[model samples]
Target: MSLDVDIGHASGRGPRDLNEDFAGAVRAQPGDRRQGLIAAVADGVSGGGLGLEAAQTTVMGLLSDYFATPPGWEPTVALDRLIRAQNAWLADHNRRRRGEGAALTTLTALALQGQTWTLAHVGDTRAWLLRQGEQGPELSLLTQDHALDHPDQRSRLTRAVGLDDGLRVDFAQGEAQVGDTLVLTSDGVHGVLRPTRLAELAAWGTADLAARALVQAALEAGGQDNASALVLRVQGLDPRQLHDEQAWGRTLPVPSPLRVGEALDGLTVTARVADTGVHLLYQVRAADGALGALKTLHPSRASDPQERDMLAHEAWLGRRLTEAEVPGVVRVWPRPAHASAFYLLFDWHQGRTLEQLMAGPGGPPRVADALTAALAWTRTLARLHRLGMVHRDLKPGNLHLGDDGQWRLLDLGVALSGQENAEQRALHAGTPSYMNPEQWEEGGQADAGSDLFALGVTLYQWLTGRLPFGELEPYPRGRHRREPVPASRLRPDVPIWLDRVLAKALAPQARQRFETAEELLLALERGASRPLQPARALPLLQRDPRAALQLALGLSLALNAVLLLWLALWR
Candidate 1:
C-alpha cells in the first residue's frame, strides 16, 4: 500500500545561547513508493565539544544517508546501520581532536514505508503514537527514555550516540494506520510538556501548527534547554494493498485437522505427534519419503482469529529465521485446492524435549552437561536477539535436545518481535514460574532481556531440578523480592560462579539482569576461579542431616558422662 504523510517540525534554542536541537523530514521520490519517508529529531548533549554540529550532522546525515542505503534492506536494519556508521564517524572525529569532551547527541528517527512505521532511537529523545479511540484519543509511548528512572538521577542519560565506541540503538516496527499521528521530540520539549497537553495540541489543527504549538507549550512551561518537535500525519493507504501490509500475525488462516495415513498436498501423515486442545502436531512423510513435522491449529480453534493469527505468525517467523543456530522450517505446505486448511512443515528432528530428557530415569543432567546446554541456548538466543526476535516462552518444555547432542529451539507460537504493538504484548506468552518480573506487569513488553531471564530460569531448573522463585499460586506482577536459594546451596556440585551467573540472570529487576545473551555466555565461560561465599548459611542439618544427627547423639552421650563424673565426685 502507498503511504501519504503530512510532516511538520519546529526547533528552538530556548534559553540557551545556541540552538543545539535539529529536526527534519525527507519526502520519498516521486512515484518511488519503496523509498517511503524519513523524519528525525536530534538533541546535542549540552556540554559536548561540538554540540551544535553533532545535532546538525545527526539529523541531516540520517535523513540523507538513510535514503542512500541499499534499496532491498528492511527499514529497521538500514536505519540501524546508518546510525552506527554516523556514530562511529562522530566518535572518530572527537578522538582525532583529542578534546576535553566528546561530541554526543540523542536521536529518534521514524521511517514510514508502505503501511509500516520503523523507529530507531538512542538517548533520551522520544517517539509517541496518537490515534483515535472509541471513547476518545489513545496515546502510546513508543520509545523508553534512556535516562535514569530514579528521580534524583533523571537528568542524566545512560545511553547516547557518539558517547562510546559501540552504539546500542533501539529499533521497533509497527503498522501505521490512516489518520494516525506520530510525534517525535527532544527531552527539552517532552520533559516540560505533559503527554495529555501534547496530545491536545497535536489534535488541534494542521501538522505544522501542531508542531509549532507543542514547541511553544514547552517554552511556556519553563523550557530550560533546546526544545524540538516533529509531527507526521498518515493521510491515506491503498485499500487493495492493505492485505500485503497486514501485521505478520494477522495474515495467516487456520486449517482443519489432518488424519493419519492421509495424503494431502503431497505430504502423507504418518502418525500424530501432539494434540494439545489448542494445537495439533503430526509426523508426516513427503512423497519422496522425507520426514517432516506438520503443525497447525486445532479444528476447535479454527474460528478463533487470535489463535489462527498466532499460528500463522509462528510459521512466518520460522521461515524468516534462516540462521543455522535456529531450527528451520522445511516449508509451508500450500493450501490444496480441495482442502481448506493451512499447515507448516518443519524438518523432523528425532529427539526428546528438554523436559522429557530431564525427567528421564537419569534425572537432571550433570553440571557440565547443563553448562554446555546453557551456552548453546545462549548463543542461539544471541542470534535471535540480533534478528530482533524474542523467544518469549523459553523453557525446557519448548526446547528439543537431539540424540545427536544438539539443541533445537521449538515453539515460536508465543515469540514476538521487539516492535510488537500493545495488543500483542498483552498476550499470555510465557510460563508463570519462569516469567521475569516485568512480563507480569500490565502491558508489560517482552524484549531480549525478558528472554534472557527465561533462559536463566531454565538453566537454574536444569542445574537444581527446581525453579528459582517458588512457583506462585496466582502469577505475580509488580515487585517481587523473594530471592532464589543459591544453586550451590541446593546442589553442592554446582560451581559458585555458575550460581552467581544464574542469580544475575534471574535478578528481580530487568536492568539488574544480564543485558545480552552474549554477556551471560561470557560469564559462564569464565567460571569462578575462587570459591564464592554462599548467599545464606545452609544449616548443617540441611547440608547433611545424617552427619548432624550423628554429632547430636555423640554430644548427648558426652554430656551424660560428664554429669555422672560430677555426681560421683560430689558423693
Candidate 2:
C-alpha cells in the first residue's frame, strides 16, 4: 500500500472554520518490516478556537512517530501510541493556553501497514470503506465513532485525541483489497450528503477527486461546519494479500452441491434467523465446549459475491466488538474465509432475550420487571453509548440475560455512524415496536438519545407489560405516538419520581431527553437510594452539578419535599 492526501477546508458561517483537517500517507522506509500505511483525516470542533491547532498538532505529532519507526509497528500498539502522543501534546498545549482552556476537535486517522489497516478515532469524525459493487458500489462504516451518544454516553468525546489529558481511542484492522477505497473525514462531509451519493462520488472518480467532490457537495448542500477528507486506494504487489482480503469477508460455506448433513467445523443447522438477510442461527458448542449459537449465511445464497462479502464483514465486526470487552455486546469469531459464506459463532446464552420475557404467558395482567432490570439496562446502555456505537435495534429481543447473571446486548446488525455521514437515511434497521417517532416522521438515523428512547420503551414494556402506543404490527404502518403510558398505571408502586425520569427519556424531541444514559442512570442510582418526589424530578433533570451532587447523598430530596409540604400547608 502506498500513500496520498488532499485537504479541503473553508470558513464556516461564523466567519472562521475552527475545524482543520490534516492528512499524511508516509511510504515505508527501506528498513521497514511491515507494509506501508496510508493515513488521512478531517476534524471539526465547536467554538472554532484552537480546534484547528489541536487537530493540526495531532497529525504532525502522529506522522513524526509513524515515519520514524515504521520498521516495527503493529496496528494496535501504533494506534494507541499515536493517540497517547496526541493527547499528551494537546494537554501540554492546553496548559500553555490555560487562560483560554482546551479546544475540542474530533479525530479520525487511518494507518495502513501492508494489506492490513487500522483506524483510530474520537468524536464525530468517521472512517469508511468502499469496494466494487455488483450493482456498482457499496460502502461500510469501519469506525463506529466516539461521540456523546453511544455504545451510550451523552456528554460527548469520552475518548478523543485531544478531548482530555487521556485519549480513549477506538481502533480496528481490516484487510484492504486492490480497488478498495478508504475514506476519512470530519463530521461536515457526510453530515450534509447522503450515503448513496457519497458512495456514487467515490465510485465515479479517483480517490483525490472523489474525496474533494464529496466535501464540495456537502458545502453546497448547506453544510454548516468545516469539512475535510482523506481518500486512498490499495495498490502495488501481493497476490497473497488479494486472497486474504477476499477471504476476510466470507465465513460460512454456502451449501452447494455438497450435502446438508455434511458438517462445517461442527455447527449443525437448526433454524433460520432472517430468511432475506441470510442469517442462520446454528446449534453448536464453542471451542471451550460451552453451548453456543452460530449465525452464518447459506452457501448457495452466499454465491452472490456482494452479499457474502457483507455477511463476512458483519461477522468480523461482531468479533471485534466482543473482544474489546465493551460490555453488553457480542463479537464475531475470526475464522478463515472459505466457501464464500459468512457466519458468526456466539456463546449460547442460557436465559431468554428480554423480548421473549416481555410477551411470555403470565395470564395477561402486567407485572413490573422495571426495578429489577433498570440498573443493568441503563448501565449497559451507558457503557456502549460512551463508546459511540448505537444498538439501533434496542428492543427486548436484542437484549439478553445471561445465566452468568451478566446482561448481554446482542445483534448490532444495523449499526451506523452518528456523526455526519451520507447514509443517514439508510439506517432503516430497527424493530418498529421499539423505534422512536423519528423513524417514521423524519426517517432520522438512530443516535444515543434515540437508543435511549428505545430503551425507555423497553423499560416501559418490562414494567407495564404493554407496548408504548398499543401493539406495533409489521413494518407496513408501524406507529409511535407521543403519548407514552405512565409507568405508575401498569405498576402502581412505581415511584412518581421514577416515572418522571422515564417520561423525560422517552421525550418526543431529542433535545428534551436525558442527554446521556449516564444522566438517567445517575438519577436512577440516586433515586434508588432515596425517596425522591415527582415535582422535584424535572428540576433534577435541569439542575447544575452541585444540586445533583447534593441529591446523590439522599439528603436534598427529603429536605426539599418537607419544604414543599410546609409551603402547601401555609397556602
RMSD of each: 18.6, 20.6
Q: Model 1, range 152-224, lDDT digits (tens) per residue?
A: 9987889888888899999877767899999999888889988899889888788899999999999989989
In model 1, state the lDDT of residue 546.
63
What number of backbone clashes does candidate 1 have, counting pairs of residues 3 or more apart or in separate chains?
A: 1
- Can you write out model 2's per-residue Cα lDDT over 179-257, one digit (the tens) per residue? 7877776677776777788788766566667766877777888777666767776655332222133344432356432
Clash number for each model: 1, 30
Worst 10 residues of 2 by lDDT: 6-15
Candidate 1: what lDDT? 0.77
The regions of model 2 sitting more than 4 angstroms off are: 1-25, 28-247, 250-261, 266-277, 286-288, 298-310, 336-340, 362-369, 417-425, 472-481, 528-571
Number of the top TM-score candidate: 1
User: Residue 270, candidate 1: how far off, in angstroms?
Assistant: 0.7
